[model samples]
Target: MNTRKALYQFGYRRSPDQDRPTPAHHPVVVVGAGPVGLCTAIDLVQRGVPVILLDDADRIGEGSRGICYAKRTLEILDRLGVAQTCLSKGVTWKVGKVFQREELLYAFDLLPEDGHKMPAFINLQQYYLEHALVERAAQLPDLDIRWRNKATGLKPRNDGARLTVETPEGSYDLDADWVVAADGARSALRSMLGLSFTGEVFEDRFLIADVKMRGDFPTERWFWFDPPFHDGRSALLHKQPDDVWRIDLQLGPDADAKAEQAPERVLPRLRQMLGHDNFALEWVSVYTFQCRRLERFVHGRVVFVGDAAHQVSPFGARGANSGIQDAENLAWKLALVVNDAAPERLMETYEFERSAATDENIGHSTRSTDFIAPRSAQELRFRDAALALARHAPFAKRMVNSGRLSTPSTYETSLSTPDRDAWAGSARLGAPLPDAPMRDREGRPIWLLEALGGQETILYVSNGDPPPCSCRILTIGHDLIDENGFFEQRFDASPGSAYLVRPDQHLAARWRHPDSSMIERATRRLRGFDGGAA
Candidate 1:
């Protein structure tokens, strides 16, 4: 047995619902306690909504499933108060190099600028990430995480949903005002609701080997196309915590999955690639190319998140990163609806925004899949030519896709008010609000994201007092001082520039010398009350 499982496992215990005279009710019931489910439940509980998170297993599953957590995900974790745990134990990196054979095609830095709280990416084992989340969830009284509890059945309703849970002791029915199906790709709840996915499944496989070794390799992403050790196939290497290196080797569609995972076969490949025999295998698995998503993520009362809603190729680390974004996207919207602060139509925006995000992820994952594994001779020739040109030409280097790393999604939805005035900064109207360094009135340094918190805030960048508004007002020059001028440069903040930030830390709308009414209208538009025509 894996030591991580033994150390992190939670014993199955009977729930109060199992002994209740009637089906116990919860404000929200989250199926699957993976990263997504745990995050969703924790976010909801933090919002004052009681949540019951159920998982069939008691431990973080075997293998370091997803190791690359993007900076946006780290920001979400920061909001949830667990970013330090992940950062303390994860490998932080930003540089990545793509190579064709021994020749380096190009190298890219994910985050060229500084002053952000989090790095460009962190390579931590998924189990460690989940364990951190589970620990944080345990601190929230409203979040009840039930281990050894499998969601065997789901009945959707207009008001809520009824869940049939199977436990080690017995089966019991429970009621919830809303159900989150974060049960992974083969979601039992999704199946119970007779929902199916619609997308493509590429006919190629890859071997993921987590090997433990003390190497002098830098913490950088190194991807190779047709390397000498593994000719005619792609390979990738990433450093994880505990000196565990993740190595992925492309295996053709015809490769036997079972045989390839065997240590006898995997060891030889590693020996050739590393040119040494000082490594021990921690975990190994085989996976195929799959980029698919459900037609609709939201049903009547059941909402799907994470892999349950969409599955993308592991290349570019989009799988878990995108799923974490989905959980953040749903948590705030669902909280508002459940609290009656917003109408049910608010949840529909969750569907609209995240579905579009899924589409973008799928498109990128599929393109990366194609570029890594060309389907035909013509495609292969084009890819080879592109790689050859990438060695010298900058434009061709952009074409060399070794899985475009995951970035935050920009939602062009009704919740966001389109920009009326021209903006000169990276903070787009519908995109994530970029982070910068600032200081409070006391001159103590702070990060922009930490100051924003989780609220609909009006960021007025002026030395003068901000106009009164419905939402909280953060006066830039008064409340926060841009010590390095990064905030002003990144936001293009003139004296009277103002921005309306959403709860998820996204830019909803912005203006130049906006009045209280404009801020109110934008706030209403953000909350799904207004038509958002303006």
Candidate 2:
């Protein structure tokens, strides 16, 4: 029987005697089946690491959770070979209008979505995005995805960890070299580790309604932040595929979760926000969200990922994407450690980098709420004036809507690696590999990432010069980067931009063009042969 009876049974019966999926002993155990956990499982299997992924969801994407998929998330999906499928099904919008009742207050467009390195932001239902990830996890031969299996107990062994799981068939114990917890905000495994999630719970309850609606309810996201008509309420409406639209209303501390769920109250609020009278309600949820971060993401044999590690407020769709990035970061590091390419200390950097990221996102999401509904009366008046000012000044539009989105952070400070060297300050330290066009010997355009094959490397920007034999060479420049842009247009010519890029796509080190002796020094750095070398 499915433990959660309300999850639309979908053939999961109440009786214990039923055919259940056989669970096998897996080398790596992932305790959650959300996007983050599934991504981690796929990363492991593709690299030849046998893994088992477990989740309590009867089928994937049933959870009416995360709705926004960012550019970084899409890049990860692209690496997993699911990006095209995702973009095909999802809607892409570049314009957003922030309103105050009837008058448009702030309007802005997302930065060039057809970015060199990534695709525009995508809007797919959380359910749909989850399905793609879970399906990919199901395809890997080295990976096992047990849908109804729930992690009941965790025990650390001498060399690895022992996972005790329960399913309808019965209970069994499995062993693994490592354990990853993507179980979510109320993470059981993290609790078992005695970790504390610390943050503040806001004083308002947010209601979400997914309904089939009529009327051209605006293709772009419409936000009514601190509208003068409503003293202390906020509303947002966004278009989904087909006739589906998501309408949200802010309910303050006085909101009764059960009482406010009534169709009477929900329908009216949705109508008001959507500016449509005819529509069928699909789902309605009234809940308050919290902003919290785990005290520590790593605890010896176990590691926390996604919402399990941090619960950033969902104001701007950072939570799910951040978790996926967490999985990507942790996956390769764990693989390297298990395969013995690097020391165990490398695993510690996972917590160091991702935790910093999660914390920053939490702060951004928190600030975003202030614009949704100002907490102070003075702030409310200030917003009204700011809107008036932005009306006359172009900078106001940019400033007010500056955080309707967020970008992935660059990784500048990592665990000391031998490759650590002086920075050129020309590149973003932890950003993804810059997407510059390249050429084959036959003179065809190829993506730089295509040449690297998503593995570790040093981008030797050769300016018509042959690089020494010690480093991986990518003869780039003269075509991809536009000189007028903020970033340096051409790489250094002498040794060129000799940058060591980690497998995770973060810059490890960069040096000036190489002399023969400098090439030797760069080579030693590439293989972790420096002062910080393990």
Candidate 3:
């Protein structure tokens, strides 16, 4: 027998006061210690809100789950102070190739436009991601991470919420002014609240295996439809750190998951795909795709985020990426509400914005699942014809869908003040501010996102006097100059144009000319005050 422990087996230290007290009150109590939960805790702490995070498991995730992190997710992680660690430990890839049998149908690059700080995507194991987040959370004094603490019961009150947590030694009660449910797809808190998810559960099953090997396979997303090695099925290959490759093999609905996972069956498939059996399997799992979400994420003082609120197929890497974005969207709003800077109604926008995002992800994931595994013969024939014509026709190539890919959703909410004048650039209200490289006041190159940090700010493109505002002012032509014209070209900014940005780095409003009253009105609107454009 092999006497070696698996990789990423973190030590579990017994938590303090397992049976000490009851009715411990906290400003915020977050359930689950996965990437989304930890990210939420870190963000809240960074925003000056104290939080207690609870998780049943002491260690990180077991497998290389959710390996693909999108660019928008990276930017959000950047604000949480872990983007550099992820970038250093991740495999960056932008190009993806699609194939039908032995013929390469099309190749595409996700980031055709350049000058951005982060890449289109990066592949890193989920365990590594959680490790980095835990490390980052440790640096903040406001975040209290409790391992082996499971939330078994939840009771929502008008003024606050009460939770029952079970520890190794015993169970205890906790009172929280606000509760954030990041528990996951099979959330105990969600269940305790009697909430149910609604969406489609796909019939097709997929086998995900993380195999350790060394080969000349390029660091790119390679997807195959009905390949010779894997006859009558689809496969996806992605490169991750530590010489591990993620292979997702689509098994028919009726395939025996247990038999397919056995080494006797999996090893031969690996040998056939790689032309060798030199690789070692690190982890393997069988799962069916699901597109499900709660009708609303916010309930009284309790708020749901990440997998606890929504789930989607892993096809577009939307599962984890969208969850991380949920944390980003909720963190700042929660902070404002807790600090009394914004009314509790501001938190309701979290439901409106993220529910729309969930719908968008579920819609795309459902389409991708249908395309990859068509239920009807007519759909299969259409897919095959599209794949065949993609090799020769550009239009057909556009129609070919391996996966639609994940992108940030633009919110069309009452919070985003519409533009009063004509704008030229792609940046719009309620969308994240586009990043561009420029020279800082110290004559050092910095990305716009790096300069913004996590504060509400004003971006002005002018050499003239800046408008008087309480927020930080980023003067483009004065403090920072557009070296390569990226800032001007990307934002479509003219002289004296100013943009009001939220603490989450989203554009709240923009003006062709800097107007102090208008900017102040927009800022007030964001803080839940009345009398502003909606």
Candidate 4:
């Protein structure tokens, strides 16, 4: 009976100097090969933008870090052509339970609706995710993924940025019109630029351990507050693929992180929690919670994404999810800017939008941390009372904040054309379009997202003919069949309502009985051509 863990290897072949000469100038160079960097490069290359992706390491991540993938992230990955692989290799769950000292307090279902293409969340190891993304990236001819290519120096210019990379063979210099820094939290490029990363650092420490065992625990998130097994501390348990379980134990400020991570200390805790030592320890790490972000993500020609731009506590699963969204939000804008389809100011919107999202995630994560590990005795009393009352009262249950799960950020920017009509819909302007089940004209079952190509799409849900437009037109009830009535119920569609969707699938504007001039105005406003909102 073998219990050793198997690691994945993505062989790195040295690039031949004769065949891989440094280009005079590249359109884009991504400075990390993690999820965010790989996503950026894939999205750019799919849009006909050549990209050079550099990674300091040749192997996947060491552990199963950042295991939760939100629905919006799955949608973005679906666009990159690897969502199916992720879905197949991940554990899908939506229900979560909160307990107080062996007593169940409340339960929640993140996604209670049906007819959506993706679930609320999926738990897949970060290594598996990166492997799938790297495999997908390798299939693209426009993307050049260079392993073990470490960026040592960055020189920012008025026109572009020059990067000095160190490889196994030797050092080489490369120039790019734009540089994306998807590097980790301790980004060397970020340090070289001398930018300030400001935020709050909590004194609390947390122990994350991954154990492999044969258990019958259901695929759900279980959170405990002051559980009896751990003796007045918080704990979180989640099921992942390959029969691996992730257990997070909250350690007070006075506890030594290094000592707690030792096998002797960790095994006792596991035995107490599991009532036996049937599981094998796979990986363990100790970390302090922090909520921090750079002042600005765009540093002239060098742009930062993912952990390089922002970081938050692991409570809400926002770190990797937000970083991937940052890449999705920036890739299309960068492509448009490089191809001269939009103005340089378009890049500013990325900084503005993602910064706002980072702040939101930080705020929520901070609140969850405070609730989970209250510093003051008075705070703990209130948390206890809330958990006790949550068993019977619905209001108290809502007040219980274990982790306010991750969701897509809706941008409130000048890019979105203002709604011109009195509309009532759950999908608002500047928000990502809500997915629904539909059928294509050929009677094949499809999703609303499936019909939405990678461009500005116009969704008209009416009987009248849509206006003549340059973008793709999707007329519901005609071009697509509403088999489940989800469109009308979710979108609040009227007889002549029209929706303008951006390239990133966010709703830009909507109109009631809009003519060709009105549609054109909205398009122009979205592209930053029109001065006024449509």
Top candidate (lDDT): 1
Clash pairs (backbone) in predicted model 3: none
Clash number for model 1?
0
TM-score top scorer:
1
Candidate 4, residue 517: the lDDT equals 78
Give me the runs in candidate 2 sitting further than 4 Å from their true place. 1-25, 113-117, 226-232, 398-403, 415-426, 437-445, 469-471, 477-495, 515-534
Model 1, C-alpha of 157: deviation from truth (Å): 1.4
C-alpha displacement of 476 in model 3, angstroms?
1.4
Question: What are the Cα lDDT values of the candidates?
Answer: 0.90, 0.68, 0.88, 0.88
lDDT of 4 by residue, 1-534 (tens): 113344655555665531456635799999999999999999999888999998988788588888999999999999999999999999999999998889888888999988889999999989899989999997999898888889999999988999888887777788899999999899999999998689999999989999999888899999998889998899999998999999999988888988898898999998899888999888888888999999999989899999999999999899999999999999999999999998887889899999999999999999898899888999888888888888898999987999899999999888887765676757878888999999998999988987885688899886666544656788888888888888987788877778889989999888777777788888877776675756
* Candidate 4 or 2, higher lDDT: 4
Which TM-score value belongs to model 1? 0.98
Whichever of 1 and 2 has more lDDT, that candidate is: 1
List CA RMSD, all candidates: 1.3, 4.7, 1.9, 2.0
The residue-by-residue lDDT of candidate 3 on 246-356, one tens digit each, is: 999998899788888888888788888889988998888788999999999999999999999999999899999999999999999999989888988998889999999
Error of model 2, residue 351, in angstroms: 0.8
Residue 379 CA error for candidate 4 (Å)?
2.2
lDDT by residue (tens digit), candidate 2, 1-534: 011123322233332212335434456789987788888888877766888777866765342456677776787777886777788888777678887656787776764523254554777777677777766775777776776778888887666777777777777777777899999988888877678888988777888777776666556777776655344577777777656777677888778888777888776766655456788877777767678888788888688999898886667878888888998888888887777776777777787888888878888877776665567898677776777777678777755642457567666454323333455433555566555455555666555555665577666655667664555555445433323332344233243656666676666656665455655554344333443332
**What lDDT is obtained when candidate 2 is compared to the true structure?**
0.68
Colliding residue pairs in candidate 2: 411-430, 495-513, 495-514, 496-513
